[model samples]
Target chain A: MRMAELSRTSGVPVPTIKYYLREGLLPAGQVAPPNQASYDQSHVRRLTLIRALTDVGGMSIATARVVLSVIDAPDRTVRQKLGATIGSLGDIQATGDSGGADRDEEHAQAAKTVDDLLERRGWRVDETSPARAAAAEVLARFDRLGHHRVIAALDGYADAAELTASNDLDVLAGIEDEDELVETALVGTVLGDALLAALRRLAQEHVSGSRYRTPPR
Target chain B: MRMAELSRTSGVPVPTIKYYLREGLLPAGQVAPPNQASYDQSHVRRLTLIRALTDVGGMSIATARVVLSVIDAPDRTVRQKLGATIGSLGDIQATGDSGGADRDEEHAQAAKTVDDLLERRGWRVDETSPARAAAAEVLARFDRLGHHRVIAALDGYADAAELTASNDLDVLAGIEDEDELVETALVGTVLGDALLAALRRLAQEHVSGSRYRTPPR
Candidate 1:
């Protein structure tokens, strides 16, 4: 198909498609005679994935480019691709020791808490995984707020997280094509957070409605 | 304490503190003398919440003000306050029928999937809950990407979400003070999403490592 058809099929505008092409977010289509280009089904798929990442996942174009590069990399194994893809999504800064002694102590405590949680669950994750730092930052935020009660529920949250992660992997296990598997994994990891967060709010509303229903005047 | 003290205590800068004050994100302090005003513990707590909403939660100042107002409003019940706070956070536009026929049909189908999921789980969320629309949007994105397998895992995700929501409310149940309860709920609801997303990534890394571990070359 030509650019117009590709835009129509992918529900992206032509100028936006050109912008993506310019940014190398989408690959160059096959050049036809007289300066015309032709796009195939893969371009359509790439456009869809790009929209999903930027629009729904709220990733910046630069981050999406990194993720796409990892996806398009031919040499890496599926596991390595998956690792890089997840690493690019969160954008959480790693916990550092430069915030003076008080913060350094707090960050150390939070890191220990995360380390202990991983140990208690016996989960095999790299020490430098951005998720570890992200989780530690959250713990530090809770501590700063003086909400130890929330921290007390860490085990429950971990249990739920593990269950959801298993479900995520199960979905990926069913996909046979390596490219589709990686794409689906990236989409699932990014959009899945929004899905779970929305569902959790719905569930919270349900519980709150039943538990704290206001009586009629 | 005064402005400098509040800034030092909260680690928010003086100009930013002034910005929040001018923006009505913080309440006015008591006039102590001819030129100075004095702030108390409440100012510090408010500053912490303000920073959490904007910095950690990534909320706009306007939205943060609305959330803070809901927290500060004494006339609303706990459930109403919680509902309003959650509603303000996600910022998801509700599914509408404005995107032509095909999109309208897709959105309607997505909405049905969400409604059925809620019914299947016997959840009592309001029809207008933003989460319902947010979840539906995620489903629609998956549909657009042609990844139905992710949708198939919705039940498992919901199960995990319910468990985590239960844990959230249990923590809220332990807070005796109503003001503190609302404050804690707001913080938990906002930051909990980040925490859970981080933990899920960690869990995914663990599962992927164990299942797809690359043997030594």
Candidate 2:
């Protein structure tokens, strides 16, 4: 189908489609002729996934790129994707303001920032290393909390992360294939938020006890 | 100690501290001699937690305010806080973006938009309700995918969220005091991310089958 058809069918604009192509966020369409390209249903589906990561998951473009790389790569494992995503979460966390703005531009800047962070860390990722760079962006946000505080927290977080990762891995190992993966990803995203909410609630019971025992004067 | 001393010790700034006080993000300090004010170690600690949420956890000031409220409110329960946080997450998702800029001003605007959404939802929360508009925000992103494609997905997400919350509540139920709560919060915050990271890794194996049976061509 033509670009317009894809746009009409997908609700993404021609310009935006072009932008994704340029950014390598989307694969190049089949050459129809003289500067025109054709896209198919797969392109539309891919575009939907891209939208899911950036728009719904709040991932920056670079992080989304790494996620896509893993999803698309036949050899990519769940562990790599998780590592990449955990790193990507940091990227999302780094955005100081959750403004409604030019997503494409923000994504571009985020990608560059992620690249700089990976370089600074001396990470051995290729230029196409989306996960490494995505992780770097998250680390950079961790960096922005100021060196001392972030450093203090990073050690504790890393330690805790190891334990949690093991538990989660156990859960994932039970699931079987691609369908389960998407279902699990969807579940994980929402469930993760819910889990935090519940824990915060549960923690409050304990938090409130301090108020009674150590009344402030 | 005075605000300056608190700042030096906690690595928080006087202006930011002032902002917190004005916004009720921080507890009021004791007024000292000659129109001066004094803060104690607890204030410093609270400030640190505030910074972690904002800088590391990427919480908005408004959301931070609500979270702080829960922490400070002596009467709030584990169940209430948990429910509130879950509710707040939905709120945050609801008001995340309305489609606008990529900078601070736009972020502020988006925050305001979220505030509006919470108001519309009639949630008993401040403008800072972290979850006030989060769910809607997530939904909005998927709006581009068209209603039919995402409604079921959203339902699936909600279901998963409920289950995760239940599990997390179980974890929090064991804590007996504030110290434990703090420890739990810390561990949960860090480990939770790791757990999700692990689960996401495992889930990737099944995503292909879950999203659609046919490979995009």
Candidate 2 per-residue C-alpha lDDT over A2-114 given as tens digits, one digit per residue, 9 for 90 to 100? 98888766566778778878888899889866778888998987776666665445455776666566556667676565445444443334232332343345445546654
Q: What value does DockQ give for candidate 1?
A: 0.52
For candidate 2, give the docking quality class from DockQ: incorrect
Off by over 4 Å in 2: A1-43, A69-217, B13-23, B31-37, B74-82, B90-217
DockQ (C-alpha based) per candidate is 0.52, 0.07
Q: If scored against the real structure, what TM-score would every candidate get?
A: 0.88, 0.46
For model 2, report DockQ: 0.07
For candidate 1 chain A, the 10 contiguous residues with the lowest summed lDDT are A91-100
Question: What's the lDDT for residue A161 in model 1?
Answer: 96
Model 1 over residues B110-151: C-alpha lDDT tens digits?
A: 999999999998899878888888899889989978899999
Candidate 1 wrongly placed segments (more than 4 Å): A1-23, A28-44, A93-98, A210-217, B1-6, B28-41, B93-98, B212-217
